[model samples]
Target: MRVLMVSWEFPPVVVGGLGRHVHALSRELAAAGHDVVVLSRAPAGTDADTHPSSDGTVDGVRVLRVAEDPPHLEFGTDMVAWTLAMGHGLLRHALTSLLPGWRPDVVHAHDWLVAHPAIALADVLGVPLVATLHATEAGRHSGWLPGPLNRQVHSTEWWLAQRADEVITCSSAMRAEVSALHDLDAGAIHVVHNGIDLRRWRSRATAPAPAGTGPRLVYFGRLEYEKGVQDLIAALPRIRRRHPGTRLLVAGTGTQQEMLGTRVAEHRVRRSVEFLGHLPDAELTALLRAADAVVLPSRYEPFGIVALEAAAVGATLVASTAGGLGEVVRDGETGLGFEPGDVPGIADAVDRALSDPRAARRRARAARARLRTDFAWPTIAARTAEIYAAARPGPPQNLPRPKIPTGNLFDRTP
Candidate 1:
């Protein structure tokens, strides 16, 4: 089977988990004896050097990165236009042809960023379009579109749902949310949880951080408001009271760094809290292996890939019981959970993880086993291929692309 995956983010140009998800999935599919081609964007200012096939081979997956002008025009006004430009590049290649005259059996797209071009390109190629909604615009903004940009994005997501032959989401929670938000049948959505590369993490875990007397807690992901890193910070004081000399490591960079840094200063926990901005792969794996517990305090996570990674690296997981995270972290079983903004609850869970290493290790063991059996990429890729097989391809033609509603306008779908 030849699969063409279209996404805006990919390795070395990732904004979040979407790129990693696509990379891992494509690699697994290629390993399973399938021809996998990824159509993605090249980083800014490198268009001259980048080629459609310049990315070379990433674990057997062929990448065709298009070098387009950076979409930095006037507060995201040109985002949709830029996406169309990317789609046009993809469509041109599909028509003129990939190397060796290879064409796609199916077109799989991730998120709304590439939806416009992906749907159009799939139609042109007369191939089945498999749309994976990693997260929805409405879901990200807490059930409201807020402004024009949000509304446009939400509309595109809804349009993708109606346009694609099959829609795949990361979790049951996300499936239900998309269904309710877009007024679509729940049965139309397929729930496929994101996966991690187990061997890679395990190899990087060869040298865990040296053992220290203090309990080391780490949180590595985007430090945004919705991610709830501040909530984890709020819990630190109580956590320290119970377990003296406890230290926290906050990794990743985001808009919330300044605020979080300020909050840390105000709380005067500067010495204990270290903000290591965006760790490299080897360093991240070591940190995860060394940490006593990993905290994921996300207020809105469609699916927590970090949780799966942390669990795979043998870190005791402590996460928020919200969104798809609840499905990932089974309370007192695979890992511990706390309410979205419950500082005290987070503190208690962290204390339990630090205080009882035996039980935490048991849970970590359970999580690692689950990662191998349930969340493995080969299995996930196979399941995704099944969806692609089920979808019937059709020629490119004009379809109903209703104007997406905007600004808290619910209970209506055009």
Candidate 2:
């Protein structure tokens, strides 16, 4: 099967797990004798005027990276306009370069960011449109469209879900969330968990960091409110009380870094915590292998790909029972679990892991064993291919395009 994947992020331009997910899936699909092409944006800071777009091949998969339109639009300030510009660039590139001689049997969209271009391309090609809802806007806000931006994003997600021939989610929890938020039938959504490439995440030959006086815990991911990193900071004092000299290493960056720093000061655990912003894969894997426990305190995770990465490196996990984390980290079986935003619960789980190091290693080993069968990229790719085969391609429907409302009011009409 020929597959065309439309994603806003790809390798070297990844914001989060969505890029990694698409990258791995595309490579695996290509390996399985499928012609795969990814339409994504070029790396940040590329001059769009000089290099409008470029094509390259990575790991046997063809990639077409488009540059943002040369406009005075900023993503942080004008998200909707920036996205529309991106869509326009992608659509123009596809019609002119990609679709003349070559066409895909199906078009797969990664998230709402690429919804416009994906929908337009699929409609023009008369191919099946498969959309993967990595995470929903409503889920991130705890089911409330609080602002105009949030409402607009929600409407775009709903439009994509309604227009898709098949809807794929990373976890069963996300499937239910997308269905409820978009008013789609639960039976129509497919739960396809994010996959990991164990080879890439394998621990290096270098010796792990020497054990310190106290337990060393690591939390790697975006430093956002929804990631619940603040809760992890809140639990630091309690964790230190039980296990003195305990240190927390925070990896990754986001909008909440300054606020998390304030919380660390308020807790007076500044000395015990270190913020290591965005380590490369090699450095991060070494850090995870060295840690006593990897803590994931997510409040609204669609799928915890970090958990899979930590497991691959044989690091014991201490995660919250939030969304996909609960499904990924089984208490006592895979690793330890706590309720979302439960500072005390997080402290307790960490203390337990630190107290019983042998047991934690045993569970870490179990998690590593589970990855080969459960989260393997080839298996995930095969399942996704089945969904593609099941999708029926026909004439495009005259569906309403999602309109980004300028004001508070939204057009709720179907």
Candidate 3:
């Protein structure tokens, strides 16, 4: 089977977890004896997209990168619009004009950023399209959004999901949300769950979860509002009352870092909290392993890839039960769960993991076993490949190229 995947992000030049996910899936698909190609947006000099500028290959998977020339677009001057236009042009130029002769059976796209190109290319090439909705606006909003913009984003999401021949989401909870929110048929949405490369992660876990000589509790991911970083911050003072020297390691960066820093200062748990900022994969795995427990207090999540990573690193987890995190981290068996906004609940769960070494070990074992078996790359790759084959009927039709404009090659208003 020939597979073409479109994603806004890919590894080595990652903006978030999406990049790693796309990269992992593509490599896995290649390993499964399929011709896999990934279409992503990257800087011209980025490692995944070296000198040739337009297209390249990594680990047997063809990667096409469109260097976003921000100054070129004639549309809205807003940053978001410019980004959307850049991505749209990249897809049109790469798929329709530059890579005309190239066609594949499956067009697998991840998230809305790649929607315009994936949908258009699938139609132009007469290929089936599969969509992976990593997260939704509602999920990201944590039930706060209201009015026109929210509705517009929601409607766009539904249209994109409806366009796909198959829908793949990261968690069982996400599947349910898609079915309910987007009016998708229950049979159409499948739960693949995000996977981690255990060999890379577990090896780094040799550092152990940082338990301040005894046990460490960690909350590592993007430092932002929707991420519930505030709740985690609030929980710290209460937690310190129970267990002094119970250090909290907060990893990753975001727009709210300064604001979060202010909150951390207010609590003055500054000494108790270790703001490690952004950690590389090796460092992250080591941190997760060094800690007694891992925590993701997201108000909403499509799937907690970090939770999967923590589990892979053999760390017990305490996560918000709002989204797919609940599905992956079993409440009592693998990890503990807490209400989304409940600071005390989250704090208590963290404290439990810190104090109960035996229970934490058991949870770690359960999490590790589950991640190794169900969410391993090979298993996930096989499942995704099956979706690709199911969506792709056969050889693509010999499609005619769009008449490129004398000026901008990506002008596809027709």
Best by lDDT: 2
Residue 182 lDDT (model 3)? 66
Best by TM-score: 2
In the range 285-333, model 1's lDDT, one tens digit per residue, is: 8888888889999988899989998987788999998789999999989
Tens-digit lDDT track of model 3 for 210-232: 54553467788888788898888
In candidate 1, how many Å is residue 178 off?
1.0
Clashes of 1: 0
Residue 43's lDDT within candidate 3 is 49
lDDT of 3: 0.76
Put down candidate 2 lDDT per residue, 1-414, tens digits, no spaces: 999999999988888888989999999999999999999987545557866689899999999999877777777899999899889988898888888978899999999999999999988888999999999887787666778889889888988899899999988888878776777888889999898888898647553564467788999999889999999999999888888889999999999999999999999988888899998788898999989899999998988989999999999999998898899999999999999989999999999999998999999999999999999999999999999999986566766755543422213322
**Better TM-score candidate (2, 3):** 2
Considering summed lDDT, which 10 consecutive residues are worst modelled in model 1? 68-77
Give me candidate 3's TM-score against the actual structure: 0.86
If scored against the real structure, what TM-score would every candidate get? 0.91, 0.94, 0.86
